[model samples]
Target: MNDIVPLFGFTTTPLELVSFVLSVITVALNIRQTHWAWLFSILASGLYALVFAQSRLYGDAGLQLVFIAVSVWGWYQWLRGGTAHGELQISRLSGAGWAKSALMWLAGFGILSIFLKSYTDTDVPYMDGFLTAGSLLGQLLLSRKKLENWHVWILVDILYVSLYMYKHLMLTAILYALFVIMAAMGLRAWNNSAAVPAAVAGS
Candidate 1:
């Protein structure tokens, strides 16, 4: 097994490297309920957008554009969507939330897989669609301040790490490994917020 980082794809370039690094920090801080996550997301998604396009992962690439729009919206939600006391408190997804997100993921993957298999000559079409569709679900959940988003990310990131490894994108694989850690930390941090509520705990 090779251990060295592969210098292939968009992640190997300088801006992508910085963008990738910033993405990790942004995600980590976001889980900790910090507002800097959006900044890193804006940087990282811009680079990944190119990466996915080059790899013919059009669905994933397109998702990054949506991410850009959502990031701005998320930034605003994080800043002003809190209760009167302030601080973005984490919460679990409601039943409707689960139903809707699950339906969306299923529908997206089914449709995109058929489209890619028919119109595109890409390998691993199912995996591509699965990751892309699942990411949309995860990102939306995160934007809604749902703690379960971290759980979805944990599952998705695990799959991503393996997929990137197989594609020889070692750096991105490692980044996903870090995301797994960050997601765990996020779960704990959000649970803490739930116990005492970050906005009211100090006072």
Candidate 2:
């Protein structure tokens, strides 16, 4: 799986190619608010753990393991995390929620960067930790069907493209670039979904 092969005039490992395909499908399902996205996320994250490990991106490798666990919980959340244990619905974060999320991101970045720098040989510890933290927040918000999840994803995905490029993971970089676009579309779709309830209530 680690063997490099030519693909689309570029080079990538079979692991990465498979991960890229699964990840794209996962995001497409997510944009459509389908719970099946979490199932694909588990598959993608498992493969990506190996891909990032090979690149010595310990933060990302560790993050993929976390993603797998989170995907499972997220799957459950989407099924029964709403009012009265109903299916989760698209919603916006409150002002206090936004503030809390920001604090959590910063705190996670601090702890992760310190751990990665002290315990790993990764060359981009700070960058990796920052994105890893943001990704966790984004994933949490997404699990709950929060509108702000897309905002977090857009920023994190943009930065991930550059980080993957610097690490010479061209295929993964391209995947993150695509994530940015997909996240934006998700934002619009979720926003519209959230509004429908309000429109119906006012009718």
Candidate 3:
């Protein structure tokens, strides 16, 4: 799977191509609020772990492992993490919730960056850590059916495009670019979905 092959006039490994496809499917299912998205996320993250490790992106490689574990928890959350332990509902973050998320992102970035820098030879430890932290926050928010998860994803995906390009992973870079657009769509869709409850309660 590591063998490089020409694709669309560029080059990528079969593993990357497969990862790219699975990730796209995962995001699409997520936008629809489908619980099955987590399964695809697990598969994609596992494959991408290998892809990132080969490039020596230690932070990202480790992150993919975390993603796999998180995806499992996320799957259960989507099914039962709501009022009265019923199906989860789409909801916005409170002001305090947003503050907590920001703090968590900063803390995770600081810790992961220091660890990666001290223990790994990856050339872009800081960037890797920053994005890895953001991705984790985004995934957590997503698992809880928080509306702001899409916002987190949009920022992370935009930055990831540049990072992947720097690492010469052109296909994965393109995937992140597509993720930016899809994240925006998800934000809008979830916003509308969230409003329905409010509108109904008001009515």
Off by over 4 Å in 3: 198-203
In model 2, the runs with Cα more than 4 Å from the true position are 198-203
lDDT of 2 by residue, 68-165 (tens): 99999999999999778878888889999999999999999999999999999998999999999999999999988899999999999999999999
How high is each candidate's TM-score? Answer: 0.86, 0.96, 0.96
The better-scoring model by lDDT among 1 and 2 is 2
How would you encode candidate 1's per-residue C-alpha lDDT over 11-64 as one tens digit per residue? 355544665787888887787777778878887898888866765777777788
For residue 162, model 3's alpha carbon misses the true position, in angstroms, by 0.6
In candidate 3, what are the lDDT values of residues 28-85, reduced to their tens digit?
Answer: 9999999999999999999999999999998999999999999999999989887787
- Model 2 has an lDDT value of 0.94
Which ten contiguous residues of candidate 3 have the minimum total lDDT? 194-203
Residue pairs clashing in model 2 are none
What lDDT is reached at residue 203 by model 1? 89
Full-model lDDT for every candidate: 0.79, 0.94, 0.95
Q: What is the lDDT of residue 199 in candidate 2?
A: 44
